[model samples]
Target chain A: SQKIEQNSEALNIQEGKTATLTCNYTNYSPAYLQWYRQDPGRGPVFLLLIRENEKEKRKERLKVTFDTTLKQSLFHITASQPADSATYLCALDVGFQKLVFGTGTRLLVSP
Target chain B: GAGVSQTPSNKVTEKGKYVELRCDPISGHTALYWYRQSLGQGPEFLIYFQGTGAADDSGLPNDRFFAVRPEGSVSTLKIQRTERGDSAMYLCASSLASADTQYFGPGTRLTVL
Candidate 1:
């Protein structure tokens, strides 16, 4: 079975610092990998997507990297703010548009 | 444009009862998906529909779960003989098309007591 793994533990960072989250998958040859931000009471919102052929992708202060060899993707948020505090999920997109999501890593940015 | 929307933000039901959850996809979206998220686990794919047809129903856990998209835009997931183990947040999402990014709804938190 395909599986995804995130940091699992919560990551605490000081405001304005760069916070990095990791997503690892096994037995998945994903054509694309995606990152999403989810608040406590709300559903996940699209963040960034990086393809297997693409090494990295960036949007605003967000950046994503996909390494097929390592079967891992890393998400970075620079200039982190308190408002950025939320749980981040990584999804591995196999064919047929199905996604296997990781447990997610809780990130808390404090001033 | 308005994103995906789901009704009954919260539902409390009794075991062995039946429950229905609805999802309205974004206009013109060709792909609609259903997922379940437990307390600490990530969202698990339940089903997928392309237009009015279920392109993939393999994610469905058991025969107790079923879904339909009669108009290709709105879908309903019906669960029969609900069990306490069925308690979870059911999330609906839609994308412009399959193989594209998906936009999710606030989700319906279903609890079976």
Candidate 2:
């Protein structure tokens, strides 16, 4: 089975700073990696997706990088705001058939 | 247009009871999925339905877990003999295709006492 791990359970950062979250996986090679944001009491919303062939992808202030060699993906939010304080999740596609998600890392952006 | 909707926003039941969670996908979506999210954890895949049949149900934890997508628009996740461990938010998502972007619903929070 594939195992996904987020770097931390929670992260605290100040507004205007860049919040970077890490996701690592083992025992599998995924063709696509995705990032999502989940607020309290709500389901996750898709943020970005990066394919194995692409080293990096950006959407507005959000950026994602996939390092297949290291079996890891990094999610970054530039100029973080209090609204960005939410649980961010990373998911990997299983043979492009299914998706497996990590536990997620909660980001707390303090104003 | 509605993204997705789930019935019974919350449910409370006793152990050994049977519970059903319902999901309504977008009007034109052909792929639907069911997942369970425990406290502080991400959503775990339970089943995937392509059209009217289940394409993959390998994520179902046990025999007690079953899902159906009759008529290809609505789905129901049925759990028999529910246990305390079954308490979690049951989520449903839908996409245009099996591997397309999935849009999730508010979810039904199930509490087993």
Candidate 3:
């Protein structure tokens, strides 16, 4: 069975620090990998996407690295603020626009 | 310029009942998708529509779950004889084209007791 995993534990960080989240998957060769930010009781918001051929992608303070060989992707948020705190999910395009998402990692930034 | 929108932000129903959740995709968006998210888990894809036809529905858990995009703009997810296990947040999303960045709606939280 295909599976995606993230750190189930919440990550706590101080304001202005960098927070990193990891997503690992098994049995998938995706063409595109995307990151999303989700808040409580709301839907996920798109962040950034990195292709299998692209090693890295960035948008402002957010950066994502995809290593198809490792079947893992790392998401980094620089100068993190309290507002940046949320559950981050990594999704893989499983063909035909369908996305398979990881469980997600929660990040809490304290000011 | 509006994003995806879902109706009845929250719903509560008894077991064996039927319910319908609605989704209005962004204007001009040709692709619409439905996903269900459980506690402590990410959104799981349920189905997607291209125009007025169902492009893929393999993610649907069972025959009790069905979705339709009659006109390709608005969609409805109908669950028959809902069970307690059906409780979860149902999310709707849309994009200008297939494989495009999907913009999501706030989601409808379904509580089956």
Candidate 4:
């Protein structure tokens, strides 16, 4: 069975620093990998998407790096702020347009 | 533009009862999907619809769960003989197409007593 894994630990970082999150998957080659931000009592909001063939994608201060050979994707937020605190989810896009999501990592950025 | 929306933010039902959850996707979205999330776990895929047809129903746990997208817009997820184990937040999402980035709704929390 295919599996998606994210760090379960709550990451604590100070404002104005960089926060990095990891997403690892096994037994699947997804066409695209997506990242989302979810707050308490709310649904996930799409953040960024990186194609399988691509190595990196960037938008504003957020960057996503995909390395299919290693079956891992790294999400980085530069100059993080307290407002950026939330659970970050990584979803793999299986070939058939289906998504398999990771349990998610809770991020807390303090001032 | 407004995003996706779901009805009955919270629902409570007794075991063996039937319940229906509704999802209204963003206007003009052609793909709709259903997911269930248990506490401390990732959201699990339940079903997906392409237009008026169900393109994928493989993730549905059993025959008790069924969904329909009539007119390819509004969708309703009906559960029969609900069990205590079926209690979870039912999520709905829609996108331009199956492979596109999906926009999710707040979700309907189902509690089976």
lDDT of 2 by residue, A1-111 (tens): 768999666899999999999999999789898898998888889889899999999999999999999999999999999999999999898863588889999999999
Instruction: Point out the worst 10-residue segment of candidate 1 chain A by lDDT.
Output: A40-49
Name the docking class for model 3: high
- Model 1, span B1-113: residue lDDT tens: 78899988999999999999999998899899999999888899999999999999998999999999998999999999999999999999998774579999999999999
DockQ, candidate 3, comes to: 0.89
Runs off by more than 4 Å, candidate 4: none
Question: What is the per-residue lDDT of model 3 for residues A29-96, given as tens digits with 9 covering 90 to 100?
Answer: 99999999999999999999899999999899999999999999999999999999899999998888
Poorest stretch of ten by lDDT in candidate 3 chain A = A93-102
How does candidate 3 fare on TM-score?
0.98
Find the 10 residues in a row with the least total lDDT in model 2 chain A.
Answer: A91-100
- Encode model 1's per-residue lDDT on A13-95: one tens digit a residue: 99999999999888989999999999986788989889999999999999999999999999999999999999999998888
Question: Taking chain A by itself, what TM-score does each prediction score?
Answer: 0.97, 0.96, 0.98, 0.98
Q: What DockQ does candidate 2 have relative to the true complex? A: 0.79
- On residues B1-113, what C-alpha lDDT tens digit does candidate 2 reach at each position? 87899988999999999999999998999999999999988899989999999999999999999999989999999999999999999999998874557888999999999
Error of 4 at A74 (Å): 0.3
Candidate 4 TM-score, true structure as reference: 0.97
* lDDT at A86, model 4: 96
Cα lDDT for residue B83, candidate 1: 98
